[model samples]
Target: MQQGSGSLVELLLSADNFYELVSTIQYLDVIQSRNSEAVSELVSLTDELALTQASLNAQMDEAEAEKQRADEARDEAEEARDQLEAKIAAQAAAEAAARKAAIEAAQRAAELAAQSEQQTPTFTTESGNDATVEVPDLPDPDIVVPDSDKDAFVSEWSARIDAYLAGSPLAGQGTTFAEAAWEYGCDPRLSPAISTVESSTGRVCFLPHNAWGWGSSSWSSWEEAIWAHVAGLAAGYGGQLTYAGAQKYCPPNADAWYASVLANMLSI
Candidate 1:
């Protein structure tokens, strides 16, 4: 019919539409084929869309699982950091306490030492004698006497000298001479023997009880002369009986003086 105007069913029914019917039927067949191809393409597209949706769901599940694991790991790390910080805080507190204690102990020790230096300590002896001796600052004594007073063998020699001087001016004075000789550390017989040679056993003298003929020597008493002569003999002539000592005592008549002194000593 007219180019493309009427329906195919209406064109088929007309006497002038014979060619139109043929053309229309052919067009209908072609349209039916295109519809079948469109339907097949639509089915393929629907199947691909379903498969993509499943894959997206699976990726979402995997992402959710990874996020959960990351959260758990973050929680564990936080717990470890908290425990470490707690330990550090505890150690710092303990160290601070120790330093404070050490400083306090040092301060106490310094105080005790200062107190001890200021105080004078009292010393106690073991014998239970509690006499508090107040020792004053005094000058030293001039002489220190010995605790013991001994005879020095003077008593026996004094008795012998007394027996020899029976009736002389120096009677009963033998012990005095012996004491003086003991003090001077000389032979007790040396003085009496020298007296016999110089003054005939002290019966005669130049002056004032000078029994020995010592040069310008005198005394207020026989006791004084005895001490002076014995001290001189010890200091000058020495303690031993020798020819040299005899010469030193009597240089002018050493031989006669020595002989006479020795003879008198033998008699005693």
Candidate 2:
């Protein structure tokens, strides 16, 4: 009976061991299932990370391209600005040079006039006799003469003179002639009319600036010549247009010269 009881106990212990083994096997199965799920999750996370990294790389490339374009635009703008500034500088330099040249020309004209004034001039009469004349102190050509009728005379005769002298070498010399005539108390039309007869309004002259065919005189400028001629008329011809004056002016062809000069004067 005791042996039988020991056999039964052994069987019970074996049964318990079998039950424990079965439980351990169930736990191991659960652990394996959990491990499989974790590995799958890791793979999914790796794929997502790769996709995000690619997107970031694409954005960075686009940003770099944009920056390069901006830089190129800025460089082009600067180049254009530099070119514009160069053009402006060149224009300013040219204007300054032109102004300087004009000033120099005016100075040269003044100097020549002063030199001519220092020398005594000779006038040839109708009889071909040379007469020495003292030059009077003349007013500055740059300054306007203060006479009541000066403006009216200049306004009327200058326009007429300019109209007649249009397309000629002496085109712009109307104001000079008018002013000189008013200053020296000479007939405004006399010298210009004589010029039309003698030198075709200064187109053909025997000497420089001697449009009136006056005494082989050469002048540096038209202004000086106009002033001197008007002054000479005032001193010699009594500053009037007369038959006797015309006879004295051109003894060789007095009648024709007088008629031509009168016709021109009337036209002006």
Candidate 3:
């Protein structure tokens, strides 16, 4: 009883009380360790969240960059399309203008041709003699020819022959040809047409103005040649074309010469 009555501070200092105090301290330390582990876990979770946010930001940046590239590509494509359309429009406009110009030119040309047809220009004979002949209007096909118009007819024939041989050596011999034809009762076109066939209208022949290719013959002048040939045709072949006459004239190539001469005569 005296021991139990001892001081309470001494009782607390005893081994059993001390063991209980140590146990309580250990439990408090365990609780603090668990709290520290929880704090570390929270820190790790926060770090992971931060990493995930960073990754999401990077993905968003990449997506935005891709969108910018796509937009640029679309803009470029639109620009190209617009350019192509503009070029096509320009080409179409050019073709339309060309067509319009051609139509206008054709209309103008037709108008000019009509005007020219309405106006009959005078043709003056440039043969040896200068004669101003009035170009008659379209003649009446039913009009009968009077004997008095013979000289006028011959003059017209002369003009036609002269025009036909405008650039030839026998150009100015139309009047001579007509006179010779009248004198010999020969076709006016015969001698000259023969000359055209044989010598290209006296351009090439066997010598000095020998246009008719008449038998190794040469003449002093075109007039001498013309008279001689016309007289020969009148005397030799009756101033007419026949196959027999052609054979007599050019024995070697009669058929060819005859056909060619007939064709030339038709042209005249």
Q: On residues 204-257, what C-alpha lDDT tens digit does candidate 2 reach at each position?
A: 777898878788789998889888988998899877655456667877544444
lDDT tens digits, residue span 127-171, model 1? 111111111122111111112233645667688889888798887
lDDT (C-alpha) at residue 169 in model 1: 83
**Range of the 10 consecutive residues with the lowest summed lDDT in candidate 3:** 122-131
Order the numbered candidates by lDDT, best leading: 2, 1, 3
Q: How many residue-pair clashes does candidate 2 contain? A: 0
Per-residue lDDT of 105 in model 2? 40
lDDT comparison, 1 vs 2, better candidate: 2
- Could you tell me the TM-score of candidate 3? 0.44
**Once model 1 is optimally superposed onto the true structure by TM-score, how far is the C-alpha of residue 69 displaced, in angstroms?**
98
- Lowest summed lDDT across 10 adjacent residues in model 1 is found at 132-141
Q: What are the lDDT figures for the candidates, one per model?
A: 0.63, 0.67, 0.63
- Stretches > 4 Å off in candidate 1: 1-152
Q: In each prediction, how many residue pairs overlap at the backbone (N, C-alpha, C within less than 3 A)?
A: 0, 0, 0
